[model samples]
Target: MSITSANQLELLQTAEAVAREKMIDPSLVIEAMEESLARAAKSRYGAEMDIRVDIDRKTGRATFTRVRTVVEDEELENYQAEFTVEQAKQYMSDPKVGDTFVEEVPPVEMGRIAAQSAKQVILQKVREAERDKQFEEYKDKVGTIINVLVKREEYGNVIVDLNPGEGVLRRNEKIGRESYRNGDRIRCYIKDVRREQRGPQIFLSRTAPEFMAELFKMEVPEIYDGIIEIKAVARDPGSRAKIAVISYDNSIDPVGACVGMRGSRVQAVVNELQGEKIDIIPWNEDQPTFLVNALQPAEVSKVVLDEEAGKIEVVVPEEQLSLAIGRRGQNVRLASQLTNLDIDIMTEEEESARRQAEFEQRTKLFMDTLDLDEFFAQLLVSEGFTNLEEVAYVEVSELLVIDGVDESTATELQMRARDYLEAQAAKALESARALGAEDSLIEFDGLSPQMVEALAKDGVKTLEDFATCADWELAGGWTTVDGERVKDDGVLEPFDLSLQEAQDMIMTARVLLGWVDPADLEPDAEELGDEEAASEEAEA
Candidate 1:
């Protein structure tokens, strides 16, 4: 078909119709037509010639042009598309390199093969524009709940029609063994949107904790108005779930508001979630208090929190033990997820036994190390003296608080404790020296003799080795692997070194060893000091 013979207005109409159908911009379609026409013109003209086509948006008239560039002699690879400066002297008075020469060319007559190629090119461009539009539309919808109609099932994966695009609810993302058929209406959380080789992938999830949170936001007006905030959520898919919420307004109870009058609001959510049971717990700034609420239906006798380790211990009566642990430990597991802490639940009897065991251990340590009888050691342990260091460093007034102990007795007790610690320190220093520890490390201001021995055993015998160590490697930390927290034991962790202290000591070592400039750290030190001051002011 000859380009001139076809109706020019037809091209404009086709572009507009395709753009409207694909929900894309009309300019994209016109640009694609221009490119396809340029490709076809290149086939009619020599392929090496620089040919371009421009379509008028108003008139739909296709204009073809041949372009050539003036270039250096060596750079003139394409004779038809590029020309040397000397060769272009005939066309112009003077032509420099990088100058372009353009002239109008007759439009190409499209044969069967060229027509097919142009059609394919236009289709490809339209598809690309559509994919881009869909990606942008869905990407903004991530972390939101959307309604979709199930289109089909493939290998246990549900493909849903989202009107503007399609989404996939993978089998694992579905709640339990819930199955869907064609044309099933489902509400899903827009978990993620990714652009891949095939197209934009909209990942939908029904089991996400955020889905429940979103549902509550939709059902409860206070949550939507920002008066009630969903602090955290944990889900066991179709079986059970827990959500922690806080209310900013004193009159509104977040949990009660979510539960609604006669359980109407919560029931709506439960019906949508395949009858998944939900525990709506009130959120608290105190982690232990929040955890107590999370592990509901079980009375907790005591709560012990380890903030640094991100762990908590809950002591419950023997009768409540089974309820706290729940079936197969689901209750505790949900509680852990809700609070973002590792929980250890123990019965009251078990906790009592554990405490007794610890008391005996501390009593034995003092009895053996301080040359004291068991009765005297137990007295010290009962007075909150756990180790020899505490006894040795404590003031005499503290020791005098013990029953039947005078000033002289307090002095003698501290003397014995100090003597034992000094002997142990000397032994540790000798062991560290034997392990090739240098004075540079052993004499480091903050490190004790035992700390040096521990570092030496861990192959950090030099000051440089200590400087190269990461803070976490010296103070211990918890890491999440496969959704479970694993403990990373630090060499100095047994010494009770904090992460901030480890960082300061490492930086000090580096500065002293000329590995770091003291001036370079002044800005950071100032920032830290400013932060501390700000924190103190906030506390005040």
Candidate 2:
């Protein structure tokens, strides 16, 4: 049985057309058909069957040949299955048992099984070739934008038909508050391309951070040219974003360039982000100034930075607190993220209250423990001895050296100071346990419960324990957590340890041991002194 030349030519044209449509090479189809014929012949005629099929594309002519093995009787099965020595010798003079012989199998019957098998093989090869072509086309396009036709949403996520393939738009990556409908044309940034058993797949996203950056690059010529660098960017997606921009060129203003004339450039980017408000701030080398500017539309009275803690305390006027903090703290929150600092915003009143409370705490500690005579107390007050530790730590000699007190009085005062300090020390140690100072006391050699209890009553349990104790109290025999003798009041006078140091030491001791909460340590008074002073002077 034979097919007409016209039929063969028609099949060849159809194959060529399909190959072109699928972007696959046409010759692969002929090769596929030949391989199919060979496989079918082998299955039908047993292992002895070896055949080759060839088709001429232009002429549509076909030919077939069978391969055999030549061998001896001992290798007869091998020859029957493939080819053996003697049988192989009949085809080739120097052939060996393992040699195969090719013989032209006269154009055989056009059986239904062979034709169907050939068709199946062609279809499979076409599909595989198409998949490979699709993979190659998509693999190079990773991280680029592609237009996709929206298909039905699957499980609340949009599935798009990417011509020749399909892609998924995860719900999270879809633009917030935006909707897509079937047959809608949308553009998405390609995140990834993967080859699966079914076919090639692409993952797309509209909310990726890079999407914003890319949009900026496209919208801002300066950014694209690398003259203006996006130092940092933080986005709240559909609502608002804060971008820190810096110019590499001294002459160019990064913020101005990104904003464009009359805000055209940034507005375009904002529109792309679905009307998201963008704050284009000029980045500064000074953190305080940068943070102040970052919290725009609000005036900052002061910026106190605790670099080691990665924190910044911003003080604004009573009216500007809400503005500085923004709606629901969004402004400061984004500024903190952009600046890599934790921001604490306070109004002038809050800050004043904080400072006043601290001052009162120090004054109470000084007055309660020093027990200074009225005359001396007034003199101490005049000399700025607002805290007991300052008075305790001041040298008796220094006090005598002051204009009013004489040497004999200084000596008596020193002795009285010693007695007062001893009483305070005993009280501090006693109070230590109640103040959560037991573990720190354990570090010292002779810290008794009675001593801790006494100290606790006097509010001398922690490093703050001696905040009111005189130098003589520490010198008499008080020891640090390390068991080292506390420096004498006389020795510590010149050093004048600040209240902050005293508070820090207590916190540190607690941290080292775990007896007290770390939060007990308040912000250092001296830490805020400069800003407070400036604030007061400004008010004056």
Candidate 3:
């Protein structure tokens, strides 16, 4: 309560100056000053008394008062600040039980120590207000580019002065070989904004892929107009980057629009990036066609897509292999990142030679394993008999339908094939148990003996391992030659439904073990699309 009437206007002016410097409201500073004066008054007067201070905004007047409430004797929490109605009535003409009254108290003179305390209070409040303002300004700005002035450097990270506050560009987020001087202005993406114990912090990035996409949006009008969508971005910072853009209107060419006439639009982005080459790839819904566009300037002769595995095998001309792979495998790697698909580049000659080798290997396997003659083994191989399981598990009726196979012979073949598989299963099960697979897994309900054996062979010996297996690995979907049955094609194999049947078995085990809730990792799209898992649970 040290403020006096003569210089009260000086206090208001000081609060206004601090508020402007801190980018906080002047009312907040005035409130902090009022609280500061009340604390000092409490030290001089009875500490048990409830004291309050109010500062007039325009008049620069201060009021110091002791607050008391009239209440019943038994209702008093602090007797010094509350009294019975009979006691309060002696001071006021009329008083009710709930009435409140204030007694004017003389203001305390602000000593050196009290002035220091008031200064600390005002600074604390202003800093808090500043943090809240900064958080609100930048929280929604993440993933968008902003211009900032380089303020200083600490341990190779640049502290940039944002309009609201300072942001730091961490060392890893800076583009390779990029340097900044104090007072230099540069554009950066707001990667993250976090409220820490000390204050709010904004994280900036120059290497993020979203940065390039934002840059293109500024340079390309179609993208800003919502006619073109930036599908994805992949960058090799300080050197190369690729962006996939799709046009909502078929009439407009997204790539051409981004490239502009005489390459003006894309060139602006390149200059800003300090000569980093950019690839503007037209996005396509057909993945194969998209892959072709991604690997531009290199012709793709053939593309074999493995949808289940999320992989694409591209065959190019022999002379284009080096170009397709790029220098140090950068081209294909960036293309893979852009499409979110694993891409394998091969020459047409290499693909042809590989296919021939696989066919010969499969034919030899059939002959030796089945004890069939080369001609009969070739016939089986051409009929798409890629593995012994296909033969061992085929129906007798299906076997009879194949050429040169009669009933008696079919029965004999079935006996021999079953014997081989049984022996193999026994061997695999023994090896799995020896390796450390739990006995409980082997004895688990609803899991087929064949499936348990398969899992053990794959080294999924623990419940944890079994639960985390990806859907495709369990379902084991495979590709065929252009959706046609490849009788002799050795590159593809049908999924093992026996392994797929294990999906539900593993999920059920997870629930029983309490590793996960049945509600989590629901079987909807993730259960390998198999009926066995659902039916197994139903049967149980």
Candidate 4:
């Protein structure tokens, strides 16, 4: 064989080698070469001209040729149209006016340009095939952990060499506070598998949210078996993490299951995370309850939620404030992210102060005119009824039910209770009016001026009325406009009143005549009892 033929054989062998290395078919390489030659010929000649190339697969020898029609006169010089009828008949017996002929052009020397062009086509085809294969291989592997060998680092990012190709482990994907030496064996999740011009490019992350999820799945059998589910997780990698978990089986405690026996399951995950503290909180449908749980190890007393703003105010006991807020505010910070809430932490003292301020405004309403002392003054001191208005609305029955009162005394207390409440009702109306409450009188459902005068004439003028007034005064001593004795049925029944007949009549009259501010008339008996005791002591 000549030197030229040897070089041709070497070229064929090189193409085959490249195809095998790239996992592409050898025929694809030949196709790529044919395409490259066709393009080169077209660029040199024109699209109107027909071009063809033939290659001996075994010998790696190639020949290029052009085909054209044989015309009577050479209208176009480059036509290669020479052929007598006799000679044309040699190839085709039925030669006619439009007879075509194949003219073999001498093989052009494969110059540097042609060789470069062929190399590019072969490389491009191989890359495309490899990319297609890689995409199919990795697309399904997302959300899974894959072990990749560290190949090199570029621009401060680790490049992982996989079985077939290379992937990227960007700096951000690297776990914070973790150091990686060259050739270090590290496990990471395939965050994403994307295709690029070069080949299949995988994105790996050691700090992804799913990383913890996957770790938990591996460590906790409950998670793997579907008994428990990790709803969401937030982490400050290498430091702390918060994960919300829920159990499908109500019989199983989700948090405890996730925690494993003696925390063995969770401890394994924590070890993998380099001792990162994990708070596995039970997931709750109620936002407030979920948030409170999210701030683990910190006891929460109350949660005020502003769902629209994604904000929550958590009140904790003064001693637990630091614990709830966590060291350097990490507890609340993680809670916020886990529950998707903007959290504000408050101590018990702050909450107390807030309650006090609210009480002051509510009490200022009827403290002056109504002699709240008869019912609430002693009770307030005894039971801590800081707010007077809260006391005015107490139910007489509940007050009578307290430890010290007897049934008979409670009965007497009940009769005068409505009068005491009516006075407070009038005061609340005046307060509402002062505060610019529109149609304040309309707000007071049934109380009228005539009702108030009749109640007063019956010695029911103040909140003290029911507690101080004689039974006859409350029953029938007062008269109606027609001069008929006012029936006991017309008076408001004490909550302790057992007779349904009498209670209904009084309640109906109050509702019809508008004798009380609906707001004030509904007293919290607990508060009223407390205030009443306070009032008695003050008087003593």
* Predicted model with the maximum lDDT: 1
Q: Which sections of candidate 3 miss by over 4 Å?
A: 7-13, 46-50, 67-104, 392-419, 422-448, 454-503, 508-540
What's the CA error at residue 456 for candidate 1, in Å?
Answer: 1.2
10 residues in a row with least lDDT, candidate 2: 483-492
Better of 2 and 3 by TM-score: 3
- In candidate 1, the residue pairs with backbone N, CA or C atoms under 3 Å apart (3 or more residues apart, or in different chains) clash, namely none
Angstrom error of the Cα, residue 166, model 4: value is 2.7
lDDT, candidate 3, 355-464, per-residue tens: 87877888897777677888877777777777777788888787787799899878777777778778877876787687777877767775455666667767777777
Q: Estimate each model's TM-score.
A: 0.97, 0.57, 0.77, 0.56
Per-prediction backbone clash count: 0, 31, 0, 30
Q: Write the per-residue lDDT of candidate 4 for residues 440-523, one digit (tens) a residue.
A: 222333434334444544445443333343443333323344422233443433222234433343454455456645566577
TM-score result, candidate 4: 0.56
Query: How far does residue 219 in candidate 3 sit from its true spot (Å)?
Result: 1.3
Residue-level lDDT tens digits of model 2 in 1-540: 344334667657876887788768888876776677666666555645656777777876666777676556664654454655555665688976556667666565547887788788878888888788888998998877778999989887889998787889999888799898899998788888899998887788887766777788888888989998888877777888899989999999898998899999988888877898989889998999999989998999988996634578999998898889888878987887688777889998898898767656655554556555455555655555565445556777667655578977666655665667777666655555556764555353334444455455545545444434553443222334442223333222233434344445444655655666666556577868978999999999
- Candidate 1 ranges beyond 4 A from true positions: 524-540
For lDDT, candidate 1 versus 3, the one ahead is 1
Considering only N, C-alpha and C atoms within 3 Å, which residue pairs clash in candidate 3?
Answer: none
Q: Name the better of 2 and 3 by lDDT.
A: 3
Q: Which TM-score value belongs to model 3?
A: 0.77
What ordering of candidates by TM-score runs from best to worst?
Answer: 1, 3, 2, 4
**Candidate 2 Cα deviation (angstroms), residue 263:** 2.5
